[model samples]
Target: MRLASTIRGVTYSFRSIKEVLAKANSHKSGDVLAGVAARDAVERVAARAVLADVTLEELRNNPVLPYETDEITRLVEDDLHEPSYAAIKHLTVGQFREWLLETSTTGELMRSISRGLTPEMAAATCKLMSNMDLMTVGAKAQVVVRANNTLGLPGRMSSRIQPNHPTDDVQGILISAREGLSYGCGDAVIGVNPATDTAESTRDILMALDEVTRKNRIPTQNCVLSHVTVQMAALDLGAPMGLMFQSLSGTQTGNEAFGISVSLMDEAWAKMKEMTPTKGPNVMYFETGQGSELSSDAHHGADQVTLEARCYGFARRYDPFLVNTVVGFIGPEYLEDGAQITRAALEDHFMGKLLGIPMGCDACFTYHARMGQDELECLKVLLGSAGVAFLMSLPVGDDIMLNYQSTSFHDIPSVRGLLGKRPTPEFDAWLSEMGIWDGGKPGPRFGDQTVIR
Candidate 1:
């Protein structure tokens, strides 16, 4: 493929698709550290110029990993609805971006075309978009998923009550869930990242979340974020699961690093279906982030965004109920600071939606990053304005177990109020019934965890 461009009389040439994608990406510390990033701003713009002219057909035909070698690539290619791909495969990346942003391109139309688009095509189109472009295009797509409740409905923003404790305390977890519920959060699900991944610890936590969910008649789901194997073991011990959880990667090598494979996950899917008490069709939740594959030495020379899109392709195999990037949690080395995190979060949400999946973000930052809570709040606002499906909520935006700052229980209603959004229909009804939400805003009993009574 032609991988060179001339801008301002300077010609920039790239040797491969990997280089093209890496250089074309907006600045990110991960790509730079990988030594794949553009050497300078001028070259970066030049790469975008070259990438913009590449056709979707070229991208589909030339995955970063050959389809025959990479199961993730095979899954991405094999699942394409041929008719849908044919409709847009002829368009250049620049043309595709324009089509997506066209006033006539409704959400329904995007969904129809989405089935044909490959992750490479999505990432390629993303490279040509600005921050606002990503938001506007992302807002034009709709993807809804349901387990115990629904998510991704328009005019709705949901939260996963991350009641994580340092000691795996069930009561502490329940207390956090109750506080989140008081502020009209937890419509998406109440999920926990256990400090320990033992089958017993996971089982107890899952059963506790399930108990509180039922006892309070909360219209939500519950899950413990553990390794698929650990969760599988817990399911074997009869842990009542709401949504089985796992972290995903784009390449098989990366999956291996995570101690999972396609077959292993397929087995887990079947097990969750057979054992978990949660309702079906969408029975899994997945978390993915940029730099994971590189960190695992499995990036195959690709940029983070391309690999990340492949994650959505991989996730598409199971039709997960929820998928989000733990943005900025990887620290400043990969994302650098608030600007890079903001860019990655928007790109991830946009790509996931374009590929037809429910997408959310953990819009968080590590303490060592050159950013802080103010930057995190800025990201939360941007995601809310971009029509994100959900965001993670902690006691006060501090995940003690995970050691990162995320959205707080109060941030949920604050964003909802600012954007004139509400929780899921089921949870909104429950919130109103409990006197904690009214007229699209917090009511008399808003921050009272005692409302669980």
Candidate 2:
């Protein structure tokens, strides 16, 4: 059905829900690259105006992809909380936006109603929100998940120590992990992105992280960010898997491009539950971002924000321990600059939390992106204040392996102290006991990589 709105005496009409969503999104280079972005600011505002009047039921009825043709659509519809949906399904998107911003809307209420929200509704809600609006309302939803450690607690923040190695060398990776631990950054998980994606390489990396964390008695988990199939192969070889990791896409077609199926992920999650060494209901770690679907030619005329939201919807099914958007890693073609990156980071966090996903951010930019290091630093403070679940912590804000910039180990202390947040309960105690952190301050061995060993 066509949707139309008048602005400044001009009526702009959108042919479909997809067009409305794509045009209404904050200016993302990827949308423009995809030739789906609005031609001008007036059309963009008109699209938002039309979208605000779109009822939740209308969004539900029109999945970005046809329900019969897409499993993701089916999965979203099949799993919705019926009573919660019935309560506010009649409200137009504008009313829902107002409802969220109201002071009476508590975090508990947000949590309770989250199950009723579809990814599309979550997407539409975010499009109409300003940067501060995203942060202000996003802080209301609390999503707690656990593996060897817990995350997403109120007054708490965590950091995933991404000790990536270009050569997949276990020793090089361990040194980085040890360094991160000394800085109190691995309380979330010690995750490694392997340059070599293979069973043996994954198994070796997994064993190394497992041995180090276990021997040191660190109260955290570990994961080798390899393909799910490779990790599964390593698990079959009896590698100690703390948390299984995977990259997810918003559409079935996009997931296929990643060489994954819902069934494969289901099998992987079941296998991890049956065999993972971690003690928890949450054992999966997932990474998602805007523009992944478009990158794979699977966006299906939808905007990056909506496609990104669908990833959270799919991820919630597996009960992931950690989930984040590597917001700018898709590069300048998608995010364009610091402003675009900032907009995407907030939008992703807001949509993820509203849809009941434990959300975090990489807060990064590639060298080619027009963003400077300054904006990245401000982004960390912004997300931390917004009650994000976690942020990626690298050695000096640079991922040597991935060739991008992100939050650093040094940034962890200031973020926590400035934002008045703490690490997960178990990891905080371990940090204190290990002489790495003391009473909300860095301890004597704060930057000593040798402290853990």
Candidate 3:
């Protein structure tokens, strides 16, 4: 479903996962509203109180913790207050569309979308179905969704070093929407697709992010730009198109091209780490599976998938908190069965695997078109049902869109209403058994205060 359309329909229940879990565990209403209110106070006011003590460096150092509701609340409050935190407040579909109309560029288009209640407006409403809770439940939701194997990966682009056009821009936009709008507006990594793949191009973007962050005071030392898909070192987009995955009739150079692609990826990683060091709890966004030369012939092997996994595993190993998943698969390619591989793998292999860390996805944008509105509705259910982060891609004329998801974890006290009373006794029992019940008096330091040293 196009998130932008659903922004107005967005309503937050002002509750906490911990409280809901408690209700599930005991089936009591005694503390439900109170638990939810405590979360709201922490999120709306307390968290923001601690902002002065924190710095980009400190926030990155600890980042947000799974149960650190206070910290996340502050981050959201800080973003809302800080005029420069464009990614947080203004980027919302409702706010963004309004801003677009105000900007010199895309203003006319914004006017068009603003005029009547069109499907675009409906889609925009979904964008509001987002939150700012990154730690606790939001993070847990990612784990649960990943475990459920529902989301899909949007394929990568052939051009390694593509610019921010409609196609490549869509990826980043999607990341933001998924994390920001759908799942407590948390953080996820995103990449740029340059028309060419070379160390220089990669370096240029890294440098650009650095400069932009510094210029805009966004602070770059804490973040890592992700490099997923077909990454290799020293290989420019030039170089004879090579073997062409689109038409691999026979062994051209005995699959040297494939090996080179892998090597290029290595180089890309090395360079990225060098350019954007993972200081503090920085992140690197990466994804895989670009049809590339294989568009015509789908002869992918387990090794390729393994390579992707290894890429993720490597990120996990290098800087435990620095790498976040943004797995992308183009077209109708879901996980092994109908699941999204990253989500499927996480659910099947990574559940309870990592205690504090969270896994994320690109979103549920590519569900089969034939599935129709069911897919869209299904996505909504997934968002509210599982807390899976979603990324929204804004339109670029008729062919391109921009990607948007959270850059940091956030909490939302608004989603409580979306979830009616617990569904079944079995589910409730599972909640109790899982020890996921929400309890623990709201921490004393409910406001946003971080140790910045």
TM-scores, in order shown? 0.98, 0.99, 0.35
Clashes found in each candidate (C-alpha, N, C closer than 3 A): 0, 0, 91
| Residues 1-453, model 1: lDDT tens digits | 789998888889899877898899999999988888899999999999899989999888889998778889888888899999999988999999999999999999999988898999999999999999999989879898888777888999998889899999888888888888888889888999989889999999988778778887888888999899999998889899889899999999999999998889899999888887777679999999999999989998899999999999999889899999998888888899889999999999999999999999999988898887787888899999999999998888888888888899889989998998888888888888889998776789888889885
Per residue, candidate 2 scores C-alpha lDDT tens digits across 341-425 of 9999999999999988899999999999999989999999999989999998989989998999999999988899998899999
Best by lDDT: 2
Q: Write the per-residue lDDT of candidate 3 for residues 1-453, one digit (tens) a residue.
A: 111111235422313222212122111111222232223322322222222122222222221112143322222233222322322222333343234323353313322322122111112221122222111123232221121111211211001111234433333533432222122111122234344444454444444444432342321121212223333231242211111111111112212343323334345445444533334232233333322223223222211221222223223322222222332234433222123332332331221112112333333233331223333333333444443333322221011322322112221222222443221132223223323222221222222122100
Flag the better candidate by TM-score, 2 or 3. Answer: 2
Over 4 Å off in model 2, which ranges?
none
- In candidate 1, list every pair of residues with a backbone clash: none
> What TM-score does model 1 achieve against the real structure?
0.98
Task: Supply the TM-score for candidate 3.
Answer: 0.35
Model 1: lDDT equals: 0.90
Model 1: residues >4 Å from true position, as ranges?
none
